[model samples]
Target: MITQVQVKGLMFDPYNNAYIVILRDDEQSEMLPIWVGKSEASSISLALENVAPPRPMTHDFMKSYLDAFDAKVISVVITDLNENTYFAKIHLTYVDSEYTVDARPSDAIALALRSHAPIFASESVIRKQSSEELDQWLENLKPEDFGKLDS
Candidate 1:
């Protein structure tokens, strides 16, 4: 089963020069982090910041192209995990036809935000990550606890 989630924030993970996309599922109160590349991270961050690029980026072009074709993104699902790699698919609807397109988690998420589509992850993926309840984790962390940590 796939559980809907929202982007919590972007965090830098120095080990692989990757950006971690943090996702939260309110109903389950769990969090999942997926590592993404710097370019993809920049796209996500730009959208989050509401910073429009001088020219349309790849995601922007995609959104426009889909809109022009009357295709609407229904949702994005992080559907599988293999050897630590995650896979995703974007579900789209055009007229009465529904289609699924394979995509990287990063690109799927970036497009989802642009298309105002819901995000989801497989339950197994969440379990694999061992993500604890958000409230429980937050309860154990004080603001000052993070303030002193070196980023």
Candidate 2:
């Protein structure tokens, strides 16, 4: 089982780097935050804000490539989590065949936004890997708090 989710926002963790929170679309109260590299965070931020760059970024190039090949990104799936890392896959369809490729959840999400693809979290991953305390903390967080980060 997979639950649909939406990008909640990009956040900065003062002690760490930046992270983007995703929330269950059906149950807005359920959420997860994945820490991402600065570059990836920027990419995700640009997309989330609908900022069109002068040229195509890596993910934008991917969207063009998919379009050129008549392939559509069906959805992105948050597949698993191990140790402290989370994993994801991008599902694509072309002609009569479908394919899935491994991707960082953040990049997958960036592409999903460009392609208008939905996002999903595998039930197993959520059941076993999600942190309730962290979720609660994020839920209570305000955007102003993210601006206080030294980064």
Candidate 3:
């Protein structure tokens, strides 16, 4: 089972010295947080704010390639969680044929946002990521912790 979700926010994790991209369903009942690198976070942030960089970033360049090929991202699906790592797939349609490509969640999300495609997550992944530890961490987050990606 898969549930439709959206990029809720980007947050910094001081303990891990990493950024977390939060995805949540419409009702906010299920949340998935994926730890990502600074570059990936920046890309996702730019998409979230609809900020176009002076030059096309990696995700933007990828989107342009898709445009050149007349391909459309149908959706992005967070498919699995293994040993604390999450997996995702980019569903695309080109020349009347659909294809699914494996991708990191962060990259898939950035492209999805850029292409106006929907995001989703497997029900099992949602359950796996929603734990007591994560609940405590989220509850402890301060408003200042959530912000745009630092340049």
- The model with the greatest TM-score is 3
> What is the alpha-carbon lDDT of model 1 when measured against the actual structure?
0.82
- The TM-score values for the models, in the order shown, are 0.83, 0.82, 0.88
- Kindly list the per-residue Cα lDDT of model 2 for residues 32-74, writing each as its tens digit: 6676767777778888899999988888988889899899999
List the candidates ranked by TM-score, beginning with the highest: 3, 1, 2
Q: Say which candidate scores most in lDDT.
A: 3
Expressed as tens digits, the lDDT of each residue in 18-131 for candidate 3 is: 788989888988788888888999999999999999999999999999999899999999999877678899999999899999999989999999999999999999888774
RMSD (Å) of each candidate, 1 decimal? 6.5, 5.2, 5.0
RMSD of 1: 6.5
lDDT digits (tens) for residues 10-120 of candidate 1: 988554566778888977477887778888888888887878999888899999999998999999999887765788999999999999999989899999998889999
Cα-based lDDT for every prediction: 0.82, 0.78, 0.88
Q: Positional deviation of 144 in candidate 3, in angstroms?
A: 24
